[model samples]
Target: MSDIARELNLNPSEELDLLTKWLGRESTEHVRRIRSVHVANPALGLQLVWERLEESYGSPEVIERALFVRLENFPKFSNKDPQKLRELGDLLTELNSAKSEGYLPGLSYLDTTRGVNPIVEKLPYSLQEKWLAKGSQYKEQHYVSFPPFAYFTDFICGEARRRNDPSFSLTPTPSKTSIQYPKYEQPERAMRNVKRHISTHKTDVDVNRWTSQSDCSSFKPDDIGKQCPIHQKPHPLKKCRGFRSKPLEERKAFLKENGICFKCCSSTTHLAKNCKVALKCSECDSEDHVAALHPGPPPWGTENKNSPSQYGGEGEGPGSAVTSRCTEVCSRGQSFRSCSKICLVKVYPKAHPDRATNVYILLDDQSNRSLARSEFFDLFQIKGSHSPYTLRTCAGVTETSGRRATGFIAESLDGKMNVMLPTLIECNHMPDNRSEIPTPEVAQHHGHLKSIAHMIPCLDPDAQILVLLGRDVLQVHKVREQRNGPHSAPYAQRLDLGWVVVGNVCLGSAHKPTTVATYRTSVLENGRPSLLTPCPNQLQVKERFSSKIQNATSLRSVRHDSSVFDDCNLGNTIFQSTKDDDQISSSTAPKQSGTSTQ
Candidate 1:
């Protein structure tokens, strides 16, 4: 019982109580008294409960013991009536002997049973004709033969219901003798409209080829023993008919949902980055990713490059209508691009203040609560309490247990203001909104203002976004002023932390436009994140001291390299290794190289 409880994540005492309550209601009076008199092992108690039920109701018959009866008075048989005496003895012997079998038939009451089978076989001549015609019609329409004998009764019953035959009824009215009979229902109307999927294995294209056999041992692929994630069938995911049939984006989402490695197309414990199996894509012969997850144009032929259809002119195809509809939606302030404001910041752990780590943070005012990656906690040496966290996003709801860290400090690149960050929830993975870094070149396109272009920091393309600051950190979100631009132009907004450009901004013809679309994510926690800020007195004193000792200190002892403090430096820091028996730790940090980052 203890082992069982541990396996099921339950308490042993609770398991005992549940079994007791269940058995107490269904057991006999003697068994109930025995249960009340003494405590028994839960396993034994459960067995006794099931055994009692089996004895009473498991078998089909009610009585198993034979019975005997005697007459009160009878006439005496003499020598002259030997035949009559012999007949009386035989009757008495048969009555006194043990019974051969019970009155019940003990047969399964399925379509093969006596009740429905005889009725289906001996249907009226008109009904039989209709049933035969139905079978023949199905064979002709589907280009297949009639169903197997096992399903014959079902086919006849279905035809009978369709014709509304009074003699052959599925749900007959209940009579006194048939009170416990099961009421059957006809197949739903939707089932009739379902399209049949014929087997494509044996086709004219490959009929002459040798049959594919599972028992063949001569040829085995890399995914021979693996099962497909999409169809849940025993086949390679890339070779699955269902997987190859879906569009590219859905295939990516399918891999994420099933936790299959995109590089190898196999479900393994290690991530794609750590995957040792090397597979070359057949499409482009690229070893970076599997052919199934190729990011290039789809295998299906695209429009001709020289044709007007390629440029999406009027009346090109049905796609033009969809494109125009999307344009209208975009004109109405709806965004279809994935973008957000991501900036680098230094995070100081409470336990290790001197070892501040550089981390990229996404400033999102729409999120009610901030979130950090679980890796951030280990890297910063921050300890937190475990708690159940519920995250709701545009996609769906995700419930998982996470840790809450309340001790942390966030600082800007220029080191102007220092603020204590609010409580942040740890998540296994962040939202999918990877966009091109907002560089200074992107800010130069707008003619409204370019005076503070130098102040607009350039985000490195290789920086890994580790944290998201929500509105809960109220101090950083206070908008001081804004430089507005013309319609559909990106504008710079000044916050307490620094200046940030927002909206779609085109850099050049070679570079794509930057998309700053908002992805709203709400985090539900037991305790709300309280806004925390550093004391004004402390900041004033620190600022004054720094001004007085500007040139006094010559030899500075810097723990990290000078490039780490630069605005464009996105290299990950190699921290000291910490060995723990329970948790796995890594000294190096992750880089944004491919799809393996998430």
Candidate 2:
């Protein structure tokens, strides 16, 4: 017996379990070997195995073994018999269901059999149509003629619809199957319309004569009997056909009469190409040359009464003449006409003279104040020292004449001179009828603090520090409010002594608080003011300095002339300054009041 039979004990349940486990692990090769050994009597061999299975297990087990044996041998005969192939497919479907349900013995036995063709060829007509249209295997294997396939597909689709839903009915009952011919109304209408238009526009003109194949000259010169198509009358000339070919000479003459060519300036002849008079240039050896072509004057040379030489005059060298000579004036003693009456003289000193005068003192008191406040001059330890800086100022006014008038001035900054003007800041207050105190947040609001922060950069590039000395309108309002309230101190006393820091610079309050410090002063003014007084104590400085303001000012006015003195405010100073020693010196400076002449 087999090892599985030997392992089974006398107990039926244990024996059956052992046999089942042995069968589950059986290899396909062993099954094939058994088949080969009984190849002469395959049916007998299968019955013997079934009988053995029945004795060891039961009828159901015997039936299953028989099925497995038949499946194993089915592949061997499937190519010969379509019925066996179909049977094998049915057996595989059962095996697949059993395997899915965890019946391992059936799975093992079924696995030994190669499956039959899985294609469902014998499906119902409706199913076949659907499978042929949409199934992947059917698509790969099947082909059908257009008419038969389409007709059958439509019929099967109709049947499938009825089967899927009994209530579904064919509209007006399905027609008998037949080939469909498409109606072409659009093409028919287009043809009819084209024919109607052509017929409506038809004329009696002879197309053959209009597009005659005869040479143009072959037509008779005077054929008055021939009628003109345009006039519908006989030709004007005795034998002319009305259509006349223009003579070549006349065409050439017309071109020449209009000055179309340089050579042969005649109205009735061809141009130089056919004239034979125009010659090629001897110098450039080019055929494009026309008669009387003259070389013009050089672009940069001054025009003279005498004609320019054919070889180009001596002044007209190979390159530009203007660039070879000095055409620009120096920075001094050059005068510009401002108007019909007044002229502005440009100051250009002869080269760099010895330090004759201090240019720093020449700037206005406001400029001095700005210079004193600037950290660059302080960092260089050059405060109060005369530094040569460039000062540029631009001024404009809109007069009653409705025109914008402008003026500009540029000067070297020397300490002795001052470009002065009145301070633009003015303090004004209007009375109020009601009183209310503004919270700090409300005071800090951007709109309320307009005057302090709204100052704009001046038009002059040299005016480094643009100062708007306007009264704080917000503070004025607050003061009036305080005065109206009962049991309060004076409006001036009630005013806040706060200053706002915008970016790196601080803007001081303009009014309400009567006492305030200058940007360069550490102590409050205490209602004591001087027009051009130096700060007693150094400024209460901050960590960040406004480099944009400083650099713009430096490039504009300070660095125009190179000098040891000009190095005073040449670099960034805000983040570099450390102590009091790096502050501008305290010295009362003179004041002047006038706009810089620009």
Candidate 3:
């Protein structure tokens, strides 16, 4: 005998008490497993529901085991079959030798949905007509379908009452019985609505096409030319035959409830599923796909003039695809445009793998390489040589006289292979205005760049970004303009519908955010930025350090001529100082603001 049966036979009352207690614990464990199963198989469609009273075909074994456990308490549930509303089912299951695949009487009593094959489905056309037209007077026994037992309806109504959904109607067709059952309308559609299932696929045009198939299945496209049976005129299904088929009262209620025509779902246009204005692709004016996924040659031509291939294929190289990897801050795939607000980047110290620190990097396709501030090295490590290197910034050449560092190589972790792949370079470190972290209050939420900008914006903060990468590290992307109208301006329009990312190499088309401000780098003859005076007021400092400020011409204005200064003459030694000797310096430093121009 089973353990449960043996226990019940020995001490019926005490053993049953113990069994019930353990059932509660076991049910909790079962629910956790079922919940995970439900999430994993979400496409199961109302199968593994939590509420046992509702549709729960997926969890039949669990329910049966629990219900039978309740039956084990003889005195507690000795009345009839012990399971409520399932005496007939339990007895019938005994005949099948198991619960599964057993015929349960009134099992579908509470369900309102009609399956594909109803009782009248195979009946001749004349018998179907007679049954609907004659009702009780019809003498055919095979055609006369009756409701289940009256108590079955009461149980179903009680279940509905417990849920408190008053409008929850369960219209059950009767089995063959002599009871005077009320007429129930045939279920018009399945429980799932077509409109509710939309957006399961991508694009609006796909949604419209989906609704057309499910909602307009009764009428065929070829029927458009056929004359309506009621009006004897060539008209849409919703206008004549379909409308006349319903009773006068139902017709009035339908018009009152649905103010629009059934064919088009429109008040003005009463056409079929085919709308008057079809969906057109914004790129090629074709109805095949959305502009983002348009497969044909671009509107202008196959050759895009703004193609980066012409500009020497800026950021892309031959092997970028195999080496590209993204930081953890990216919530999406690496191929799309997202906010640069939170990004993590690793910077090595002049080819030294041991001194690499993962820091924040704001993607700037406009700048040349990743960057680091002098303050960052204080917290992290910095391997710099006595040799000085130059840096070109958005403002201009900001590092004409800093020690040139090289040991670090920028790298990304290849998650699939468990290897670190090198990026452009160990970002060149520069002195900023302050060492203190920027206040979060001053940082406003910047919307995504609407146009393609020369920047990548993932910063690992948890700290602020020290690096701004230009097209050199990013995959190459190109754009072509398409006019909105026949007479629209050619240059005025720009779409974010081209150049998708593959690994790190940009290959195809995907939607990207717009660029508000792009970092444009060019080779030009300009002067270096100028320095600020020590005095708080410009006039006071200008008088005191007039000669000093003139000598510090590299601080304010920037120039392109390579006047390479040695390590002694360069850097912020002559500027104001702050906590931990901030290279950007503090607010007290002249020509130094809260923002980092680098």
Name the candidate that leads on lDDT. Answer: 1
Model 2 quality (TM-score)? 0.12
Better of 1 and 2 by TM-score: 1
**What does candidate 2's lDDT look like per residue over 1-598, in tens digits?**
3455447534333433334446634432344444556667655554455455545555456556766675556443422233443453455556555555663454443222122212223333444554445433233324422222233333334333444443643335333321111121122222221222111232342221232222112213122124332122343311111121123343333323222333422211233466555456443545554212212211243433332222111222354433211111111122210100000111112332221221111112222222222322322232242333333222211121111111211122222221222222111111110111122221222333333322211122112221211132222112211212112111111222222211101112211322222222222345433334656685664333233345443422433333423344534442232335468866655554853432
Residues 33-94 of candidate 1: C-alpha lDDT, one tens digit per residue = 54454454645654564566667655445332211112213344443433443443443333
RMSD for each of the candidates = 35.2, 41.6, 28.0
Best by TM-score: 1
Deviation in angstroms for 346 in model 1?
1.3
List the candidate 1 regions with Cα displacement exceeding 4 Å. Answer: 1-339, 383-385, 432-436, 507-598
Ranking by lDDT: 1, 3, 2
- Better-scoring candidate (lDDT), 2 or 3: 3
Per-residue lDDT for 1-598 in model 3, tens only?
A: 1275565564433433343355466544544455455554532312332343234333555445544444343122222222332343333234223333444422342221241124233333443453353333222322435322232233323332433433643546753311221122222334212222222222121211112212222223333234221222345324332343334445444433323233332222232243454445565676643332343222221122342222211212233222111211221243332222223445555435544455544444555554545545454544454434566645455444333333344444221111222233444443221112112211211112223222222222234456544455443212334212122111111212121111111122232533323334232323333232233443422322333344554443422223322222434334433235435543543455655542
TM-score of 3: 0.19
lDDT of 2: 0.30
Error of 1 at 491 (Å): 1.4
- Candidate 1: minimum summed lDDT over ten consecutive residues — where? 202-211
